[model samples]
Target: MNKYRITVADKNPLVLSGLETLFKNDDRFILTGTARTGAEFIELAAQNKFDIGVTGWEMPGLDGRAILDAIGEFEYHPKIVIYTGVPNPRIIREAMLNGAAGFYAKGDSTEQLITTVASVAAGQMVFPYFDLKKLQDDPWESLTRRELDLLDYLKTGQSNQQIANYLGLSVNTIKFHLKNLYTKLGVKNRAQAVAVSLSRKSNH
Candidate 1:
């Protein structure tokens, strides 16, 4: 049997302690590292090799989504499993699209997480508690290609003027696109709009 090496990151000390205990007890897994902060998690991931990494959506300094965005394309990146409380459909979809092997909500039982980690480590795609079909039919429709590019910049916490400068578009044109983006996402204002936009995972 393969003993999958593991690394876990979470802000909660209690959760981390529980995970450390569980991983230590599991014969099929090797607990390589545990991280309590986003910065530490990033550093650990870069320095070690792990088969599976289970982490929360929000962490210290950098949130899980941002962490995924940072080193997602690295050649040694392990399969990621998101164990977060944020149930936004947008985030769930995005995480998968960005190479997350699984997404498990915090409300799910520990048994579910255990099974998901095993399945993901075994190279199976598993989304234990969320309904992908329901999200497809939800109020949030798919975003356009240009909209996705714009959304990427928005997630970096840039201003409209700065986005316009980066995208090589006039400020008024950026504002127009921003307005359209807001309307499509059904959110008011840029910050809320960006939050929803960044969280959305629709790939169509």
Candidate 2:
């Protein structure tokens, strides 16, 4: 059987050491590389082919989101698993929008982490623990498909004009949808709207 090849990146030395040790005894997964920052991880990723990339959302030099974006531009992209301390809905949403296979909080149990990685490697979506009912009850759940598309673009940190271009909609139409989304989500600005949307999705 072919062992699953994995790479990990985080700012903490202890976390890096711990992860290395954790995978060292596991025959199913081989830790191919480890890095102290996102930039280092990106450099390694560009040079090597990996089955999975486990990284913290926030790291020195380059953030996880930026790293994921860079990876997205590559012809060959590894399945990404964000093992982060930040479990905020916005972060999770951004990771998902960028094609992350899973999000696992640092506080999650070791078993949860292992299972999440395995699941993601097997091509499944994994979310950090959250209340599903709350997401269902959110007012934003009523958003139209167009609005959802706009919101998704917003979550990627795109400007209204950028969203308009990407969605092939006019600036006026983007503004109208943004207004409707803000009212429904009870948010006043693009950043707040994106945050609320992410929070709502995390509830699921």
Candidate 3:
């Protein structure tokens, strides 16, 4: 049987060591590399070819999202599996949107992790179960803190310039943030963003 090449990245040394040992013991998988930082992971990924890239979502310098984005620049794109302790609906949604193959919670069994990686390697998308309706209905969880704050400013009918002045950010910077905010909120413009926020607030 042809073994699948895999790379693992996490901030935790113990997690890296454990996964290295686990994959080494599994005849089906070839542990190509291990990284304790996202930068290191990206470097290793660039230097080697991997069938699957297993990594935590949160890491110092660069992140799972960054890694996913970086793959587009590579000649060979590896299937990414986010193995994060902080698994949230927003993270799952982002992973799905970014073409990640899997999102496995760290608390799950090693067997489940192995199964998830295997399934992904076999052209499958695996993610922890989450409420799709709730995720859609309350996209507030998807917003970054800056985005939430911008939403509040929008609610007050603050113009981008005014909001930027208040936040001590350049108008262009605010626009960049608003662009990301609108995407996350599934809105076209400020009016729609404010409307969605108000609608969600009224329900609570």
By TM-score, the best candidate is 3
111-147 per-residue lDDT for model 2 (tens digits): 7888898888888999866655665476654565467
Pairs that collide in candidate 2 are: 131-203
Query: Considering summed lDDT, which 10 consecutive residues are worst modelled in model 1?
Result: 139-148
Instruction: List model 3 lDDT by residue over 1-204, tens digit each.
Output: 878999999899999899999889999999999999989999998999899989998877777777788876898879999999988888898888877999999998999999999999989999888988888777676665467778889989989899989978899999999999998888899999999889888999
Q: Which ranges in model 3 have alpha carbons more than 4 Å from their true place?
A: 144-174, 179-204
**CA lDDT of 179 in candidate 2?**
93
Between candidates 1 and 3, the lDDT winner? 3
- Please report how far candidate 3 places residue 118 from its true position, in Å: 0.8
Better of 1 and 3 by TM-score: 3
Winner by lDDT: 3
Candidate no. 3 TM-score: 0.76
After superposition, which runs of candidate 2 have C-alpha atoms over 4 Å from their true positions? 129-204
lDDT of 1 by residue, 1-204 (tens): 889999998899999998888888889999999999878877888899788988887787777666787668677868888888875777777777767888988887887788989999989977745677887676453453356667778878888899888767898998888777777788887788766755665533
The window of 10 residues in a row where model 2 has the poorest summed lDDT is 136-145
- Candidate 3 positional error at 46, Å: 0.7
Cα RMSDs, all models: 7.0, 7.5, 5.2
